[model samples]
Target: MRIFLLFFPVFFFCGLLHAQTVKVEYGGDPLPDKDRKKIEQFLQHEVDFYSQFGLPDTLSLQLYVFENRREAIDYLESINVSLPIKASGAYSPKLQKAVILGRENGRERSLAIIYHELSHHFVSQILGKRPPSWLNEGLSEYFEHCTIHKKAVRHTFTEYEQGRVRTMYMLGEVNLPTFLK
Candidate 1:
C-alpha cells in the first residue's frame, strides 16, 4: 500500500505532463496577427515533435520579437543579456523564452531563426539540462532547415554545410565515432 501510494503521484504526474498543452506568449514589439498565427503554427509543429519524448507540465514558451537588430539589442540589454552582433535569435533556457530580430529578414529567414531558437528551447526542456554546446547548436541548426508538413517532414543541408562537409572529407577528418566523443 505504501509503495502504491509513493508511485501513484509519479505516474499521475507523468500522465499530466504527456497531456499538457504548450502555451505560447509573445512580448516586446507587437507582430501582425497573421505573423503571430504563422509563428504559433510553426511552434505547434515543434511542440508536437517534442511531445513524443516528453515535456514538462508547465511548458509555456515566451517569444519576444523585435523589429530590427537595434531593438533586439536594446531589449536584450534591458534584460541584462549582452547581445552578439551576428546573432539573429537567442533562447534563454532559464526563462523558457526566445528572442528574435524580426522583419529585417525575409519571412523564410525569420522562420528559420525561430525554428533554430525554438529547437534550443525544446531541447532544453527534454534534457532537463543544457546539452553540450556543439550538440545543442548542431541540433538547432539542423532543425532550422526542417520543413514540417502535415504528412511529412524533410531536412536539407545548406550550401555552407555541404562545403564544410566536403572539406572535412578531403582532410580525412570525418570520423563519426570521434566526433560523437
Candidate 2:
C-alpha cells in the first residue's frame, strides 16, 4: 500500500506535466474565415522564413486582432503591459509568447508587425533571451522592412538623407555602438 501511494503521486505529477499545453487566445473581433486562412498562411510563411536561421519551431505563438486601438490598448493593458507602446507587437520571452494587435483597417501593417515580433521571437529563442538592445530592435525593424522593394529602400534612404525620416544614429533609441559593432 505504501509503494502504491508513492507511485500514484509520481504518475499524477507526470500527467500534470504532460497536460500543460500552450494556450493561445485571440481577444478581438473574430476574423472572417477567409481572413483567418490568409493570416494562418502568412504566419506559416514567416515561420518558414525564420526557420532558415535555425530558430526553434516550438514557439506556439498566438495572434490577436483587435477591432480598434481602444480595444487593442485595453487588451494589452489586461495582459499587464503598459501602452502607447512603440512596437505594434510584442514578444514575451519569459512567457514564450507573442501578442499582435491589428489595426482595424491596417491589415498590411499588422502583417508587418507580425514579421517584426516574430523576428524578436526567433532571435530570442536562438540567442537564449539576452540579445543586445540594438541588434534586437534593429533586427525587428529590418524584418519589418524585409518585403520592401529595392526602389523603396532607395527612396527611404533618400528620405533619410534629406532628413524626412530620421537616421538610426539620430534616433538614438537603439544602441548604435553595439549595433554598428
TM-scores for all candidates? Answer: 0.72, 0.57
Cα lDDT, model 1, residue 9: 15
lDDT of each residue in 9-48, candidate 2, tens digit only: 1011122233211123443566566555444444444455
Candidate 1, number of clashes: 0
Predicted structure 2: lDDT? 0.55
> Roughly what TM-score does model 1 have, to 2 decimal places?
0.72
Worst 10 residues of 1 by lDDT: 1-10
Best by lDDT: 1
Alpha-carbon local distance difference test for all models: 0.71, 0.55
